[model samples]
Target chain A: MSTLRRNPLRALGGARQTPGFGDAGRVVPASGITSLLTGITSAVMAFLAVFALALSLSSGQLAQRWSATLSQSATLRISAPPSEIGAQTAAVLEILRTTPGITSTRVLDQDEQRALLEPWFGPDLPIESLALPRLIEIIESAGGFDAVGLRLRLASEAPGAVLDDHTRWRRPLVQAAASLRALAWFSVALIGVMMAAMITLAAGFSLAANAPVIRVLRLVGARDAFIARAFTRRFAIRALIGAALGTGLGMLAFAILPVAGESGFLTGLGFHGAGWLTPLAIPVLAALIAWAATRTAAMRVLRRES
Target chain B: MIRLANVAHDYGGRALLTGIDLHIAPGAFHFLTGPSGAGKSTLLKLCYGELRPVQGEIELFGQSLRGMSRDALADMRRRIGVIHQDCQFLDHLTLAENVALPFVATGRPVPQTDLRELLAWVGLAGQAESLPPTLSGGERQRAALARAVIMSPEVVLADEPTGNVDAEMSQRLLSLLVELNRMGTAVMIATHDLALIRNAKAQVSARVLRIQDRTLQSAGADL
Candidate 1:
């Protein structure tokens, strides 16, 4: 029992790579039709699991990016006739500089304004002749300015100026990103459960097929642990191999994805940095599931049938 | 080495054996003979730790069967070898591997020379690498006997070890059992063949016990 608990693979006659006297562990073949089915199933599930993990990690990164970029800044848009636009923009900039916690402010240059509108309007449009709103970008310190007091001062000084703090849009974007991360994790959990169920069925089939061998071992005074070890070790190794194949293929699939541009959600849809190590755990997790499933099946059958 | 007191065994409310008292000492030799459906196999099962007695206590090597854990019973069973009437063998294994199954079950390093010698003694040295399904009935019996004695068990219980062999092969197997008995290994053989019993009596000092009408009795005079 101590030996079994300490080194399960050794106890199963797998300690040595060669077969000899008392090497009955190979009596149950590690590769067979049932094992093939189990391997294919594990590979498919692990492939899905890798994608789910990548998606979850990517969504988490997306949330962090959105929170960092949107939380500390406010935009001031001044919509006035062509005559008063420059005056309104100058007044808003002055008010922003006087406000506490307003560290820096910048009014957009003609080219920067044109670049921002290039996505919506054609680049050939003449920015000098258009009656466009003058936009002021405001950057806040750790302590942001009081929005209500600043808005009152801006209303009195420049009635056409409107302050947009970006909170209304930030709230929904952060919520959507957080929800996507949760959904991705849920997908990963579902894949694990499905894989466990499939592997359990495979383990049960192997146990049933090896009933005669188990009987002979028992007749010769082999303990239940000895019989169970033979089965669990075989299945565990099979699952590990299958999961490794799946994880490798999945990672290769991720590598070929189209590069993410700066415009949309695809920019944060895959693994990065330390997140690459996350999928490696799939194979080990598969092996653990196989071990637990095979052990339970072997013990139950031996108790009921033997 | 094994004792059963007032042992009663039943199957689904049907009593097959009752009031059975047996004691197997070291180097003792006994033969059990009974009619068909007379519970000969059941009694043999009880002698080892395969089947627990229903009503009475069985002590194997000084430990009560009721008190021993399943693993502990398996430990005791390693010390007591068994040969079934069917001569069950793992068909996937070689004949040599089948003969060394006891050592395998006990997780011991099987000595190649000892395994070779035992197979040669059983007349199966030439067929060591042959699969079990390809062996003859007598060869299977010899292989099972070799496997049983490989552990040098204190007691051996055989359920019609010669059931599938010819008379000549039966005699040869009986001689092997007598030789084991001479080496201080207690043995009990359950068979309905009276001629084999007579042949065994001529070679060794043996006792014959018979089960009749659900009771165990000495059939020494009948033998």
Candidate 2:
């Protein structure tokens, strides 16, 4: 190809016309360098966006886990005299065994009782010194154990049994987690909207400041789209670079976090499996914001000036 | 070539230019002169398609100015070089780069030798690397001329190119325009300097168009 054919400017123009873009990659008006700072801001925004996404996902997972684990299992407690305690426990187990969704029932040994009390009282305390009720550990099948009917049957056979299904606590826990997920998603959306607005404002200021350049370029026969492309491309690249840096830093921060044994939310707010690629999306988010901001500003400026 | 028929301009309903008829054939050197606020610059802007006429007709190379597209007007601008009284330049660029801005904006590849030659011709060869803000008024005017004519346009419109320069510097700038006219480019200089006009008349047969009362007409035969 001829030397003229090899020019970068023409090659920049060969693609879709970017509004107000001067040359494909031609940095005109020297203000194009501002993108470096703006790009960093965009990257930071993307990093935060990633955190927002993680919060939403983790909250949802927490809701799902709470709903699955606590909704099924229920415990039956029988209090009776020393002579009647074993018989009441046996009757409660018999009722549970015939129940459709009850998977298994087991009576706790004295060692387990001592273990449960170890946190509040000293472990060396004599087990025989206190009166203990018979405690049964009930396991429910997949859907959930029937609490209402089982409680009625246990009441008829054993007068002192109390059925605890965990409905009151489980409902509130799952609701709290679901609400948290919604809030996290709302936060991510708000950040995206703010990023769009910031980019627009920045791009608008850029176009406004470069008024003379635009006039000069226009007078020299450049289309409005040509002038806009320079800005759009610059900001997009800046946002992408900024987003990449931010995402990397965010991930690094996440990596050093205390694992499952340490922090609750912090440990959960990280990319997992294919989620690792989630940070890579930071650059693309920045690019999208830059594109939107630059496009709006470029078109408005071009329309008004042209 | 250009033609204007009863061209009147109004800004917010106040007459800035009224009922003006003027013509300049190809290669003609014309001077537009009037007192401050008499609309000399406004006339020049109208002539060059910067400001559209409010109540008259303008034709450039035989195309109606009223119906022209923005792109079409821009293309016409490339053929006409305009130097404003406040010659704006990208302050960050060196003088050489400023002078070559027209070619760059137009996507015309400017040869390095040609740029150097043009700067040298304007006596700015030594200051080529200096920014516009650092250059003196005289240097800026010269640089502006170099920029305006970088593409070798068919017509040149200068709005007080020598307004801020000394007499000697003014003469030097006038000589550059004269040289360009001699090379077949029509030059219209908007200035209040009769001495410069007379000095230019001695070298080239020139016509004076005086703008007054929003109208343009030839000066009295004596002056």
Off by over 4 Å in 2: A1-40, A57-186, A212-222, A261-268
Q: What is candidate 2's lDDT per residue for A1-306, written digit by digit as tens?
A: 232243444345432222232233553555645666586677778778878877888888788888788866777788898889878888877888888887788888899999998998988968876778878887888977667788788879999898888888888888999999999889887887888888888888888888887776665456666677878887887787788888888777777766776656556666678777766766786788788889889988887863
DockQ of 2: 0.17
Q: Which lDDT tens digits does candidate 1 get at residues A209-270?
A: 87878877888888888888989888888889999999999999988988868767887787
Cα lDDT of model 1 by residue, B1-223, tens digit = 8999999999999999999999999999999989989999999998887888889999899889887876777777678989989988987676777888777766778878898898888888876766677789999999999988888899999999889999999999999999999999999999999999999899899999999989899999965
Q: Best by DockQ, which number?
A: 1
Listed for each candidate, the true contacts retained, as a fraction, are: 0.51, 0.31
Candidate 1 segments whose C-alpha is farther than 4 A from its true place? A1-21, A29-31, A74-168, A260-262
Each model's Cα RMSD: 7.4, 8.6
Q: What's model 1's overall lDDT? A: 0.86
| Model 1, docking class | acceptable
